[model samples]
Target: MMTVPSKLQSVNLNLWYGAFWALKGVSMAIRPQAITAIIGPSGCGKSTLLRCFNRMNDLTRSVRTDGQVLLDGQDIYASGYELTRLRKRVGMVFQRPNPFPLNVFDNVAYGPRVHGVRDRRTLERIVESSLKATALWEALQNRLDRPALALSAEQQQRLCISRLLAVEPEVLLMDEPCSALDPVATQHIEELMRELMQRYTIVIVTHNMQQAARISDETGFMLLGELVEFGTTKTIFTNPRDKRTEEYVTGRYG
Candidate 1:
């Protein structure tokens, strides 16, 4: 059998905000074109680790990092690595829908525009295809001129994802992407994620273990900045090698 290469990886990755350590020696492989869910209680460094993949943590003040975060086996933190290109290849969606305060067409066109795509027809195609990919085109194609903020919460979230898709990212880093929506909306978003994993590598940090079990192909359990176990979702939840992972998955403790 041939082993699939990791889309992204962290080796001995550590992070600190001022004097507080947020992630400690976390190392794991994220498979391509699949969903990898990181689950733990609040403040377990799951979000921090997700941000490291696209170097989003660098925006925070008083932050320090060590070790390697690799994309396609190349260290993303290497000196002179182009962050713009890195972010283009690895996009992010936040806990809340954060569409730009712009019309739907422009919101989806934002990334391509920033990357120097100025042709009107090209932008139109990108917007249409991106929205279609996120399952929003059918509903919003006629409302391309409408303000993104006026859409329903789920629509806004899907639009945010469309915005990322417009950039043609290879890996998507989602930090609680469904926490802001109702259960029905969350289900829709989960289904969208399942569809997206067919073409993009998805790494999601979720507080809901059930969500993780439902969508992720691989799951990693983090605890207070440490990864206690990482494996197939079935093994991690049903037959976890670590007692802590079993306990957490069983609702014994967060």
Candidate 2:
């Protein structure tokens, strides 16, 4: 059997927002080419832990952290770690589909352009491939010149994922990515996520237990500021060791 390598790891991670402790010694490993879902109630450190991967939590004022966030055996919080490079390597898709106010072509090309891919043909190919990877090329191929915001909500979300793919990111961090979409759109995004995991490591935070159960290989349940349990999706759902995890997974409490 082939062994899966760890793509990302968080060790004894603790975070504080002013006087509030947001994450408490949280530790887990995200495997390569797999979807790992973080599920918990609101304000339960789910999003906070997700942001720690690419250092998005640094944007928040009065936030302090102690502990290691490692990517491929390197500590991202180390002084020499480049923030821009970290973000580029570990791309993020937010709760809302936030496409730049640009045409579909430009939207997909944005990352490559920022990284200095100026040749027109190369940009075109990258745009097409990225869109194809996200399963959006057919629908938006002829409409490349149209404004991204003019597309349907699901299309916009897929476009955002395509934009991330254009950068050739190693990991994808999604924070409740389907929360803002209708049920049909949510299903579409979930399907897209499964496809994308063939190439990229995925970590998603979702409140929808059914969604997590459907899409994830591994599941982590966090509550208050602690990671209560982490295991295979089947095991976590069927036989959570922690009572808190059991309560949350069984819909007994959150």
Candidate 3:
């Protein structure tokens, strides 16, 4: 059997905030149609790595990057590549659930509209399908006209996800998506992730080890700014390659 190419790859990646290096020579290949979780203590460059996938860090005034990030074998940082298109292809969800003050329907339709989707029927179908895919259709079905900010935090987060799905991104980068949710809501999001991995390539930055163990196929452990170990979730949690990974995962140190 022939193996498929990686969906995303980084080679000798380094990110700098002015002169301070945030990510130091980090590199990895993410398999397509799988969930890869980046786990580490706070300020360990987990989120920075996720931003590099779609070049989100470019928005920061002091940020500079060296090395290459390839998506489907193409270098995204090369000249003539449109950052707007790149970002649309690689969607992101932040730590908190931030829904707009607009109505629920418009919130999910925001991306499509900005991308020039104008037909009422087309937008409706996209909204319904996207919400259904995130498992929020039933709860949000009747209240499409209500403001998105009125929903619970978890619902709002799911709405944000639905918005991303509306655009049909090939890759999803989630930075601590479930951190603010309660246990029940967190479980729902976790279940949603498993379902999502069947279709979209996902890279998640998480602090919860059990959540990583439950959801990820591959786990990357980072410390300070270095990737200490990266392997199958079982190996990282049970038998890590690096001593630092073993200590961090086993609750010996952060």
My TM-score estimates for the predictions, one after another, are 0.99, 0.97, 0.98
Per-residue lDDT over 1-254 for candidate 2, one digit per residue giving the tens place of the 0 to 100 score: 12576899999999999999999999999899999999999999999999999999899999999999999999999998999899999999999999999999999999999988999999999999999998999888899999999998889999999999999999999999999899999998998999889989999999999999999999999999899999999999998899888888889976
Clashing pairs in 1: none
lDDT value, residue 15 of candidate 2: 99
lDDT of 3: 0.93
Ranking by lDDT: 1, 2, 3
Cα lDDT for residue 129, candidate 3 = 100
Better of 1 and 2 by TM-score: 1
Per-residue accuracy of model 3 over 1-254 as CA lDDT, tens digit each: 01768899998899999988999999888988999999999999999999999998988999989889999999998889898899899999999998789999999999999899999999999999999999889998999999999999999999999999999999999999999999999999999999999999999999999999999999999887798888889999998879889889989876
- Top lDDT hit: 1
Q: Count the backbone clashes (under 3 Å) in each candidate.
A: 0, 0, 0
Model 2 misplaced regions, further than 4 Å: 1-3
lDDT by residue (tens digit), candidate 1, 1-254: 02999999999999999999999999999899999999999999999999999999999999999999999999999999999999999999999999989999999999999999999999999999999998999999899999999999999999999999999999999999999999999999999999999999999999999999999999999999998899999899899999989999999998
Q: Which lDDT value does model 1 have at 180?
A: 98
